[model samples]
Target: MAGKSIIDVLENIPREVIYTIVLIAMILPLLRPLGLPVPVSEPIKKWYDAIESLPPGSLVLISHCNLGAYPAFDSMQVATLHHLFSRPVKLVFFSIDATGLVVYDTLLSKVDPKAYGKVYGVDYFHIGYIPGGETAMKALAEDFKAAVPSDYKGTPIDQIPMAKDIKDIRDFTMIICFTSAGETSIGWIRQWIVVRPEIKYLCCVLDMMLPTMRPYYEAGQVAALTGSAPGGEYEFLIGKPGSGIKKADAFTGAQLILLVFIIIGNIASIAKRMGKGGVR
Candidate 1:
């Protein structure tokens, strides 16, 4: 094997074989995760601590604005919901985007609050989707009930014991936004944060939007943030490994395979160049 040219071996390997190996690497993790250790980032740790530090009966407002990027943001949502539900906080959920309504329902179904001993209209309340964008956020900041009269299911806000006392955004101890849209957080900051500066604000955004949010996080506008991979990190931190861990395993495996291929290709090229020179 040492005598044989590495270039010959690598160059002869078919593209189909490479593709099959990559596919297997991705699928095998989904079936049985490798349970890879994901390092918790500072931002994610802060996000976790922000929630953990909250008093048991503290009120939390979750503003979900992700629309078409559910797959990317769903893990974070699920993990956050699990974390929140595991605690004794009173939660009020509302969506700024229309598509977020469906996202909220899907997320709720995945992280069934009832399973965590959370009762509907008591432990948590969903205000459904509000349509005024930044304007709606401003309105909700001033008077929550006036902005949203009913829950997602058409139950009046007053009917939900948890929500009846939430007169405005200031009533909540913390406000967290899980958004896919790049501009959604800005809207929250401008509308909600600006009005109620005392309330701590946290955000979970798509990984791609991390760059756009770093400045906000740095400026103390966003107390904490968890974007993309940090979702898995949060899952790991919370000790509840679900789809995020599985996805992280697949992601790690895929990257390793790609790296191996790149190294092999480079080695094969170098060997080929040496062989040609020796023949000359």
Candidate 2:
């Protein structure tokens, strides 16, 4: 230890210490987030504004299609639902895939619309999973009742006051889909958006799908777009810090720590080389 060079010391940082620091950085934020500021990007800002600008009593349709990978889009869905519930809009949730029903229920439980003074049958409705993929989406666009005759709980749609007027896709004031696959968005675009061009469309998709949808967004087919890391940004913009905020805080802390270590290591290497007359 006495003869060890500064470079050696810096490069030999104990794996245990690094792991411990990283663990603390992640866990602390989950327990008590630092409330760090997250910058709002154009896409997320657009998504927020689209919801904020909706008129009261406007009915919204949300399509959930990523059931197996809930963790990836859970924060986005929660934050979106929280924002929607905060407004005067009526929401109708449906799934494109069978597994999406489980994910939808999980998110509903976590967001707890009841806490926001929203009633199940009066303020919001959940129609559960509808199979047939593109064909089902087309049917829903033309005749929602025929596509989904009952709610997720087997209750007739006619019994739900909020769903009484939702006859087809055009009945919705806005359409928002959180999907992990391109087919989900493409189906909506072909069956719903193309048929009813007036209905506003917004999507929250995986980061990789951004390129596939960017052209539509640019052409005004999608009023707003957000995905992946932008979920945290949306949470920040909404001023309702949730899991996304905590995750962002931890991510920022970890990156900062990594940057600091990189700087120190470089400095130590340079100093050691200078002491050795630049031989190394």
Candidate 3:
């Protein structure tokens, strides 16, 4: 990244004001959450409701496939996890992205501190980052424990309460791929959903991906979808109605700011084209 220079200095002046405005926009709405009925798209609603309805203690496999980024996606990840926790599911977390383990561990700590005692190697497990990405996914589908002998805390699978019963990938009731990347979701669909033809597969991804991933959802490859904070806010508003709702407001404000900037730029360009040199 470059340090501030003349143009950077000029640009940064408005940045602070814009940030404050955005902060207020987000905060005010959250403090008084819009209760905006962001219609839960059927897929997302189904996904959310499914997870919400799970019997407590149901084991869920959460894979972080994206190299965790931004508070929006990260927050969404946490929101998803919180939803899982609310259902009181036993979470088995892993990641294909090298940085994924660190992100999930951090998210767990921040999102639900009390749940930490859910036991690292017992109720909750971290299989750490697996290399070979897609190939590893295929391998795990065959023999999950063989692919990773131990969890993140260095405990053997046989010794762990959850793993003791989970002999292979088929053992998991559902697979939740929380990622911004398509690698895990696509691989799970190919190697697990298609091959096994039993276990449920859901994808929690960034909203920007909906266009491309819609086909997979339509094809029944993904059982459910929850992308971006709008989905998170929708869930939160119904329950806690906290940061997720606020984040949605900030998102709206940021979009408005961009739209204003675009309109101003277009007006300037039109003025110049009309030979007035954008004088106004």
Candidate 4:
């Protein structure tokens, strides 16, 4: 190590070596999570709290709005489904966009409500994709029966035991909307919240939508606000670790490794400026 200055060693780290180190940092956690301390953020806390407080027979409405963001929203939706199914609450599923139906199979396959002993018509139901976007939102608020013609399986809504009693937006004790089309989210507020205002609404959007939607939470229009980023926190709080937890571990490991490289790069740059090498 004498002939090669510290700067030289740091700067000459093989590209493959750097990549391998990063890969290891990411892979180890997925294989065996270190169970690193996960600080629960306020947003995740609020969302978890809302779910925890649901009455035994409370009915909850779930709407997934992102058409092409399964990679982005999968953890949030999966962790949420796990938490909900863990409780004795009922759930109704639908999509704001027609394209979002692709998400149902992926999400349900991961959650597998049967594993939780959830019977389809009794505990939960998926009403499939409703195509009207904001227009759909308004109709849903005024009349749930009119808006949803049949279950996602094509069974008439009236025939579905769990859905038979659902009258309008007012029937659901809480409304949880995953990050979706902005207007569609606002449509829920205008059509549902503005008129009723008692329904507990939590808007789960992407990290970027926090700024725009945070005010709704602050204004007490939305019961709680969360996003895709801190989805792992929900898992931690509920004591059910899944994709969110694994993603959190991998993410933390990768970031720390990148930070070390950043620090080493800065040190090498400073050493050069101080004339440690012959070139300087």
Candidate 5:
């Protein structure tokens, strides 16, 4: 009865309908759980199998590229870290973003307080926050001690038992960057991967950015890329849906609902347009 066009009313209807559809999409997948078989890519499979093959006490470098408004990137990073840590890998935490320290500290506390408690410096260490974006990373590749004199806790690197003999980046086996930005990933590749071709690099990147980073993947510069929530969820469904996977499913459902709404709106728009044009 209102003067509003039929298209407008139809669009509005679909908007509400979409909410219900999204709920169904999410609830269904979560409840029924597709149990989709994970077709492991060679790179991802290599990274997984390689980490799993680590001799129980191998050290892994975990880099929080930067802090974000949402914890999606952080969640993905932590999920992968959890996977490795769950396998009992020794890890060291460092952040390129100053804001990341807060999130990292909070995440570490919730994920594994006991495992973290066991190896403060020996098995696990937080190098804390560092300065100088790419420049700092470049310096670290050459001489880590010169770049960061002390860990995030202000403990002198010389004092930490594990860091005593570790003078540079080469000390670690792999460099794992959980980042969304190009600079962070590229920096690692330029400073470490390019310089130290023998060392491995894996990225836990956000979903939208996956396409952008695909070139690196094709170039074989990145050893592995854990794509968005699908990657996280696949890992989870395989025995792991980390928060990344859970959030990914939610993201997928949201997109589906949006698409349905768009379709419905177009249909209503056509109907209204013809009605206004003398029922042609």
Candidate 6:
């Protein structure tokens, strides 16, 4: 029997070794983030631009419904909130999903508005969790104060000072929502968007739901619609490193390692085929 050639030896490399290499690639970044470059996509650019275009004293209504995940809700939520608070925009936050209340607290704890020199009731305030899913959106759209007469903590809407003039749905320069629920996300378009054609809506939803909501973005009904896939790109654009960068590094590292292995395997296969033929 003929001894193995170089191609044969290469093709016979152990699968366990490849798996171990990929595992190591993913883990090393989590321990110490490599600060790898994450390219910004067009949608992410649109999202950032929408926020950046906000003029001073621009009112932005914020909504989020995210049950926390390590890098899912963590990256975009923290980074975007930091960007929003850094500016001079006035924000009003509310939650449609009941579970999102917890996310609100956790999110705020990480990026405190006060730290950005924002006063709670005036610059930003949470309206807490409004129970009715789509119905709440409709009511809030038609009558901002009638829907919720008080702030999240039961403070009267009139007392907040900033929220006092939200008499019209068109009052806000934009409405930003980070959501996982199809109802709340799509509901924003149906309820508020349809009624007020001019209001810009920025949506950051779960990546899995991107395809379902992408039509709106393409049609231009949604100012910007996206998910957390390129969250590291967003962080870099905003100049804050968080879970996005770490997550991107881990996944990219594993992928690059696997890609190298796949390329090697294909080359070995071609070499073996040529060696058996009269070609080489």
Backbone-clash count (model 1):
0
Error of 1 at 79 (Å): 1.7
What is the lDDT of every predicted structure here? 0.84, 0.84, 0.70, 0.84, 0.71, 0.84
Once fitted onto the true fold, the runs of candidate 2 whose alpha carbons sit more than 4 angstroms away are 1-36, 253-280
TM-score of each: 0.82, 0.79, 0.77, 0.80, 0.79, 0.81
**Model 5 over residues 31-101: C-alpha lDDT tens digits?**
65555444555556665766766667666788875556336664555556666766666777888888878
- Per-residue lDDT tens digits for candidate 3, residues 1-280, read 1453333333334666767865676667666666555554666577777687777777788886455454556655666776776566788888888888778767776667365446566567788888897898888778888998888778777888777777676677788887777666677888888886667787877778778778988887777876765655545534644455556655676677767655666765565566665222
Return the TM-score for candidate 3, rounded to 2 decimals: 0.77
- In angstroms, the error of model 1 at 161 is 1.9
Worst 10 residues of 3 by lDDT: 4-13
Superposed model 4: Cα runs more than 4 Å off: 1-34, 65-67, 254-280
236-272 per-residue lDDT for model 4 (tens digits): 8888777888888888998899999999988888878
Output the lDDT of residue 45, model 1: 88
Lowest lDDT sum, 10 consecutive residues, model 5, at 229-238
Query: What's the residue-level lDDT of 202 in candidate 6?
Result: 93
Residues 1-280, model 6: lDDT tens digits: 1676667766778899988999999999989888776888888899899889899999888897657543476888788899999998998999886777788888888897878999988899888788888899888888889988888789988899888888868787898988877887889899988888788999988888999898988887799887866788898889898778778989888989989988988888987777752332
Worst 10 residues of 1 by lDDT: 271-280
Report how far residue 198 has shifted in candidate 1, in Å: 1.9
RMSD of each: 4.3, 4.5, 5.9, 4.1, 4.0, 4.6
In candidate 4, how many Å is residue 56 off? Answer: 2.3
